[model samples]
Target: MFYDVFVFLVIILTLLILSGLVSASEVSLFSLPSETLERFSKSKIRTHKLIAKILEHPQRLLITILISNNFINVGIALLSTLSALRLSYAININPEYAVSISIIVVTVLVLLF
Candidate 1:
């Protein structure tokens, strides 16, 4: 039981770090600081419009990144839960019960946040 809990913690922490890195990379790619822009870079404002134009398709970029990140996070959660159950020999436990409980806890915590 203790070992399973430990493994779950390790996995969760690893996934969180990975997710944070991905988010940071996305933010860096999309972020534009006005102070850092060149004096002659058209319009003089460091707006995302320039980035959007460069991307060729802005909406698709947002959707694809959002969907891909969500899929990865969900996959990580499921894998962590399954790893816990397997470690504890709790194979008979319902996956829905475990996942729903996790989702409920996360939703409540997010609301608090």
Candidate 2:
């Protein structure tokens, strides 16, 4: 019973840490300026053109970033669920249920969005 409690605590802690990282990244991404985004948007084009593109469609750029971030978050959640299954035995009760519900929600989100 003690070991199970420990595992549950570990799983909850892991989820919290992951959530913090995701939220931080989302906030940082939203905070980035058009010029800063342009630098990375080019991918391979000239910096000047990238800046121009970003300036022209800032909202589109932000939307794209949001979409990408959502996809990444879904991927991370799914991977975490797999990790939980591998690390903990029979992850289908209590804390494991939390992970299961989260996985299902993420899956639904990925499919719906």
My TM-score estimates for the predictions, one after another, are 0.47, 0.44
Worst 10 residues of 1 by lDDT: 35-44
In model 1, pairs of residues that clash are: none
lDDT of 2 by residue, 1-113 (tens): 44655565466555545555656655665677766666666656676565556557658866765676565665556565655555445544565766686687656644433
Whole-model lDDT per candidate: 0.59, 0.59
Model 1 / residue 30 / CA error / Å: 2.6
User: Candidate 1 residues 25-99, lDDT tens each?
Assistant: 567755646443332244545564465354456467667767766765775667666664554456566666766
Which candidate leads in TM-score?
A: 1
TM-score of 2: 0.44
